[model samples]
Target: MDDTFSPSRHGLGHSTNLVGRPSAWMASPGFNDAPVALHIWGVREMNPALFTMLDQAETLAEAGEAFLAYMVAMFGIDPEQRDAAPGSRKRFRSSFLRLIQGWGFDSNGPEGAVLKGWVESRFGILPSFHKEIIPDTQGPVWQAYVAERMQSRFHDNAILVQLDLLFEFCQWAVARFAYPGQSHLTLYRGINAVDRHGILEQQSRRAAVIRLNNLVSFSSDREVADCFGDRIITTRVPLAKVLFFPGLLPSPLLRGEREFLVLGGAFRVSIEDI
Candidate 1:
């Protein structure tokens, strides 16, 4: 596990070395107000050996199978604890599986919090919401627990690693269907918070710098995105920015058409009509 972001970071007075760059050097000089960051780590720096196994797979299904297999192999859960019989929940999922499940229940719930923490640790994109707006990272509100929530709950979780594999697999699948001329996929997200509070900067009437949550759901269908909000925010997401999408997993877990899990950062976006 990467100790760069430990649960005891605040308490232990430890330094957190962010993996992703937040300065928006990728943006042009005029669009520098909004710091755009893609949630990714260098393959060579963290785990070069991991993708060597991916070199053998040819098809999407095969890649998915390989992804699941690699995830299970990497799960460090105790064998006896893992094999324990399911009681009330029908078929009980392992600790790692619950993080994904938790995301379904509510994006502001415990699972969502942990997943956001994982994104922050790995991608350096801080979460913009907790129960409410995380206005300031240095404020008293943030110091209360920080990310100890991730460390305290389910001490035996490999969900972060599982999500990492899931992201890599999604990235691979996105590349498989890459069009010859296209560099980005148009993704839409409907948002309600257009006020002074949530937005990082109100640069213009149509365009503003908004800080999205570390991990967020978006739609490829404009109608679906419109259904969620009074205002629609459309972003031309590069294939690399997509973390996960529907149909990527054979399991019914990610069921839906044109839905996506996108990595978040400060993005200057135009608000479109709903």
Candidate 2:
């Protein structure tokens, strides 16, 4: 129990209406309960093989290879390419570092939708943005997200599951050494409009309960985050919920930025206007 978030409310803010088996899509009942659902999906229980590799591996590079191999065997994501085929939504090959890079390219695009959808299913956190605001799990925003997620999977069949691996690995590594005694990453995110994000509860003018996009990129470097927008919000993201971090993977593509890709739920964050 990270004291930053209290279990008093027991929900993730507002729940969106999904037609079919709700558990398949949204694992937890509400905003605060999202973390509770992760109990069952702890990679050790859900995926022992991957967890073992992350635990026993000596180097990050070695762990990264085993990580990719798991995806290759499980999803048939072979013949790794750097990027998806241009305009080919029906098929894709860039699944290795796909989720992050593709997401960095366009969070509202096919890759972004898939990543967000995966978070919703696994972590029970819904996406905050997909071309527009997604207040609830119904209507055009949710429909568009579902369509985009399904379409992107045509490229790499198990890309969504592959992302699950990414999260598990990040948690394993961070646990070993995360600023010692800190379970949350001290990260910053810059946004042009805080209103556009889902502010579930307004604790104060400077702080609020914000429901973030399921898979969101944040910067460990405050100055770098400031470059993205005029308003800045900094928060403590639980290490268990982090998906990707700088140097977590050996790929050169991730070397350029001090960014951490965090799985989002409703967070009590402090806002500062630059």
Candidate 3:
């Protein structure tokens, strides 16, 4: 499916050797804080092939599609069993790994090598997910179970849950990489955006200050309705030309032509507004 991420030595057969170590991937903040990781591998070593795919990808949509395909090949739950096990909430950590391998990652197989190479060449040699590393840890199962939950709750819009994960990665990057003084970074998956409510729910716990640019939009009106109804905490800054529906933002604080609403939860109103 990923022509760009296809292994260069495709005919040479798959290699079982996981080239790099998982400990190296631990550099990411997820490993430090959470008992489990978000993705199968680390981000340090970008695979030549994966990079090539990303480079050739024409538009944002195409890039996102390609990424989702990769995610499916690595994570998406079985469609048949998708609705079979209902109302089940599993751990995030175990679920994440199981999703990756469930996409068909085996240590012994031809496709395994190809997939591993695709993974390694794209993301770098991954750390061996040895059973010992997480011994006796009841870390939550992440992606797969989450995907299942989304599918059950939202039905056709299952991708929204995964999108939230991608944006969550962006948030993690901002929290960890951005300079301490740069707290004003824009929240790409904003609070008011309907589709972003899932992400905003997660962000409410961590971020105190966030930026909302004018360019942001969502997938559906229902998403917007879901957003406001969720009772998540966040503030929105309107762009110069843009104006949100007054009903959508019940607590609007207008400054000149633009409105800046402080939907209070974790954050207090600024002195100027107070």
Candidate 4:
């Protein structure tokens, strides 16, 4: 959420709804009603000491406004439209924070929480549901696990995109290895492409299996392939997680042509190009 994004450079025009025009790899359906990967419980859940920092003299409405502003500062949601309505900011707080706590199907904090139980039941990681099993050291594997879980969860309801992660890693590789200052990370996926969302079953699934098999092809990773191999890469950082640590990923990892993105399907390290 870096506020440093130049509008002309980043292409975030004066658009309010981001439902249609996401990065090419993302596609429209993914943004429309995609799965919620990681939803923080609340503004209070953001920092343990946040509630203590609030001002008692301020009205709850003003307090909520400030809270959302603080969140906007943290997440860096673009100021696409001016926030001008009287109670709009507070309403943002009530809705966004409330949705964070209530809407996400899974989460990574606290015992007896709604998201925690959902994660447990969905992934079959029961009994120790609240335990922090995703280790910091196992960064790649932890991320892959999350992505796979997201795919499984949204299989019936959402259009998942693993493409952005690949693009990010590719850009990372180019910036890290190609040229230090010549970091060209802008990989644009247009907004016109479309894909199917309806489930493929019966003869269709078999036909899909045959058609996909027929279209399959492979090539060696010569230097040229290594230069732009994001098409083959699939690891990705979740959007929710990326908001917190914007610069943790270096570009070098993305450019490597090996199948390093998916390590045993338990871990993944992918990047979006843009």
Q: Which candidate ranks first by TM-score, i.e. highest? A: 2
Q: Which regions of candidate 3 are displaced past 4 Å? A: 1-41, 44-48, 75-274
lDDT of each: 0.56, 0.62, 0.27, 0.24
Candidate 4 TM-score to native: 0.19
Off by over 4 Å in 4: 1-49, 79-274
Instruction: Rate residue 226 of model 4 by lDDT.
Output: 35
Tens digit of lDDT per residue, candidate 4, span 9-55?
22211232122222222212232124233222232343434344334
Question: Would you list the clashing residue pairs of candidate 2?
Answer: 11-30, 11-31, 11-32, 12-30, 12-31, 12-32, 13-31, 92-155
State the lDDT at 246 in candidate 1: 65
Please say which candidate is ahead in TM-score: 2 or 4: 2
Q: Say which candidate scores most in lDDT.
A: 2
TM-score of 3: 0.26
For model 2, how does the per-residue alpha-carbon lDDT over 1-274 read when each residue is reduced to its tens digit? 0012222323442343221223322322142333322332544577887777667777767776677677767776644444444354555554746667766666677777777777666645556567876645657866887898888344456565566566666666666644435555668888776765656688898998776655677888898978888888888776656667777765654445587777665666789999
Candidate 3 clash figure, as a count: 13
Candidate structures ordered by lDDT, highest first: 2, 1, 3, 4
Q: For residue 262, what is the lDDT in candidate 2?
A: 71
Of the candidates numbered 1 and 2, which has the greater lDDT value?
A: 2
RMSD of 1: 7.0
Question: Regarding lDDT, does 2 or 3 come out ahead?
Answer: 2
